[model samples]
Target chain A: MKFTKGRLLEKAKEISTPRARRMSMTINKTDFRKSMKKLVDSEGFKHLSTITGIDVGPKIELIYHLTRENLVLSLKVKTSKKNPVLPSIVNLIPGAVLYEREVHDLLGVTFKGNLDLSPLLLPDGWPSDVYPMRKEWAPQDIRKAMEKP
Target chain B: MATRIPFGPQHPALKEPINFMCEVSDEKVLSVRPRLGYIHRGVEKLAENRTYNQNLYLIERICGICAFAHVTCFSQAVEEILNIEIPSRAKYIRTILAEMERIQNHFLWLGDVGHEMGFNTLFMYSWRDRELVLQLIENISGKRVNYAMNTIGGVRRDITSMIMPSLKEGLNHLEERAKYYTEMCTKDPTVLRRTVGVGMLSPSDALELCAVGPTIRASGIPRDVRADDPYAAYEEIPFKVITYDGRDVASRLMVRLDEVLESISIIRYALDNLPNGDVRVRVPRRVPKGEAVSLVEAPRGEDLHYVRADGTEKPVRVKVRAPTLANIPTLCKMLIGENIADIPVVIAGIDPCIACAERLVFVDTATRKRWMWNKQELRKYATKWYRKK
Candidate 1:
């Protein structure tokens, strides 16, 4: 039922309908930019609510939630946790700039085309590769690491 | 030739730790580069370790002013995963507290704006009047700032007869004052001169830049989470999504003032027609494996929360997107092509909660005549600049 309403956005790899107001679809990392650009231009999903990146073992899942009217469509993409790299969506939706930086700072996903992926949510002098949001980093370890030179 | 200025970490106006590196030529601001993350608490990283119920208190502390909004968003998301609807009485009570919170937050913002523009009289007046709502909230919630009023399934406390009368009386006073302040802001030349036609953000820019709450509403967009996505009893309580075409600092002030009035009516309606039922419902300790997105119209703007459960007491992931973070990019957009003197007013115009949003302080030096001014000197310069005009 939800797919018919959003048939245009459907080269969707897999559909998972949750509740009724929000729907989540998993798309290949390769198809993410193409789908989001179309979602912005023709489908009126200009407002990028937020981008959530979660570290789920071997992969970091990045969900970009876009809203139009009352419906929220989240496009989920997973990249390898060892070296997570995804194309930036700043050119399509300008508001995704900060959200992308935040994802990079915490989960260590590098957006290839982002102008400044420099630590957004992390403090100024934070270490380059110490991404705290990954599952393995404990609170004490992060605190100790932050205190170092 | 242009020189760069570091605006904060110890604010001149906002009194918070946040910085904006502005390139200035004479008095005109050429461009703005913002540095945030001074107080990043790693709340999301911590949430992954704590249980679902324990996260309620932890998440509530995300913002002092919008404490209830944060909890409401968090609880609603968790409840969705649990798939148990809260009772009608709880929904109505939650709506009242949320609107009451909006009233107090807007009043606080008005005081901050007044302080920023160097009109301390407006500051004194708005803050003094703000106590009525705060006292009313204190009476119901026991603790003022962190109410802890909302739980996963429902609200914690009920609005009793003892608190209800005072709540009604306080709304009457706040309504009158909201209107009076509106008239004062629109009429007073000092206020008008500092605010009117300053920090202009067009409707299109506001939308594309993802501005929210009064900031976007001021720019003539009626996108409100309360009206659009009806959380609590907001759909039942009749209210208008106030918007102004002014698209400037003046419009932002008017939008917040009008929202205070609107919130008052929403509270009054919720109270009068409140449904009778149990305030809370019991749910199992473990939530089924699911992910749900919840939204609440916080005092500042749309507050978004997402919860992922692995059929355990502890959540797998919890994400919080505060309104100020969304507004910061838009704030940067508005600051360009404006004078240095107008910086404080424009920054204050967004109603930034910098602790939750970001913070950083740095200065860049080169072959130039550097006018190193912190918030005090800049605010004084702004006041004097307007006074001499």
Candidate 2:
């Protein structure tokens, strides 16, 4: 009942592997959404604290952080930059709206079905085209771009 | 008639720079949209470039009041990644510092909450008593704001026998003062009239919104990071998790006051059982390639830090999630259908760190104006423009 970090990761690996190749179970996008809903409703991982997005080379990896008891289940979902989109978990975890909005604004990832997709952190008129965290966008260059009328 | 009022990035009562676009009809708040990110320093991006040790100081600067909690969470994440066992003595000291911070921070909030409610006597008394805890922290860390006492593995300062007596005396004084403030606030009819039954967040709403700290506790949830996770010396200490079922501003105040008493008890217990050993253990400069999360009970609520390192001096990724961020959505929800006059009091009930919660820009659809202006434009248009000129 006391969930250590090791035990939680082991559970995730057990659920992910066995049925799939490439060492981990890469659930299809539809299956991933269904599994996430099931986890929240049945498993009691109700609190969605944050959704972290990390750009890994060709794909952007999204980690959905959920907590139940002392265990944090990070559901990892990866999508390519060319078509970076994921089903919005806002309806299941209403608290995730701000965090989801943050990921959308900062990383330029599209969260499908997000009602309030307006900028969460960046000001309006901040070049809609520029994402600050990307490698190609330098801080000085962003500032210069913002200044251009 | 319906109208929208703009509460600012520079309001008098708002301690930090944040703007709120509030829609009101018949002097009642219909809804409020918070416009933030005015003070965002790009801390996450900065953390990516700085060494793990350097980020310690940077994280501390995230919020001046919650500096210790931030660095402690950051250090714990690094320690977890490196598989370092902090000395038992170091853990005890860290707990003591954290409790000390909780004590002073609650006192500060007590003062601010009283001020927001127009109770100047309570404000003056609470702040006057708060200096004792601040002085205790200064004695241990040599500074008031950023302690610089926490390292990756453990604490830099040790609690010596000579300072033990002084700490006890300070706690005794604080306990007496806190009792007096609690009595005055709890008994005062005006305070009750203003705070009680105002900005009520039901338990279901709180759970759905994932409100943390005293906010959730006010709604009758018994989740405390210190109690649940048992980080540092918290497992060794004895303390009760405080909760109130009223789910109102009064309930929130009661929870904080009760926790202040508990914090005193924790500090006394930590000092009595203080162990003798090295304050800090040496940790490797480059942590192993791993990701870890550490949660701490900050004065506000649950403070979480997620860290990822790639066996380098710098952390590959660092995400700082303050309790204020978790509580904001709930606070915004409560603002709906409430009288406009009570807006400040309701907002203060959550005890937000404007610096932390205001991490997003608000866009005005009606005006078609972008709220996320660059620093240069801010300098050109905001009050700072006149000052600079």
Top candidate when judged by TM-score against the true structure: 1
**Top of the candidates by DockQ:** 1
Clashing pairs in 2: A120-B360, A120-B361, A121-B360, A123-B372, A124-B370, A124-B371, A124-B372
lDDT of 2 by residue, B263-380 (tens): 9999999999988889898887988897777788899989889888898898878988889888888988988887655666788899885421222243444664545543223323
Task: Give the runs in model 1 whose Cα sits over 4 Å from its true position.
Answer: A1-6, B11-15, B354-371
**Chain A TM-score, cand. 2:** 0.79
Best by lDDT: 1
Instruction: Report every candidate's CA lDDT.
Output: 0.86, 0.79
lDDT of 1: 0.86
> Lowest summed-lDDT stretch of 10 residues in model 2 chain B?
B354-363
Which residue runs of candidate 2 sit more than 4 Å off their true CA positions?
A2-28, B11-13, B354-389
Model 1, B129-164: lDDT tens digits are 888888999999987789999998999999987778
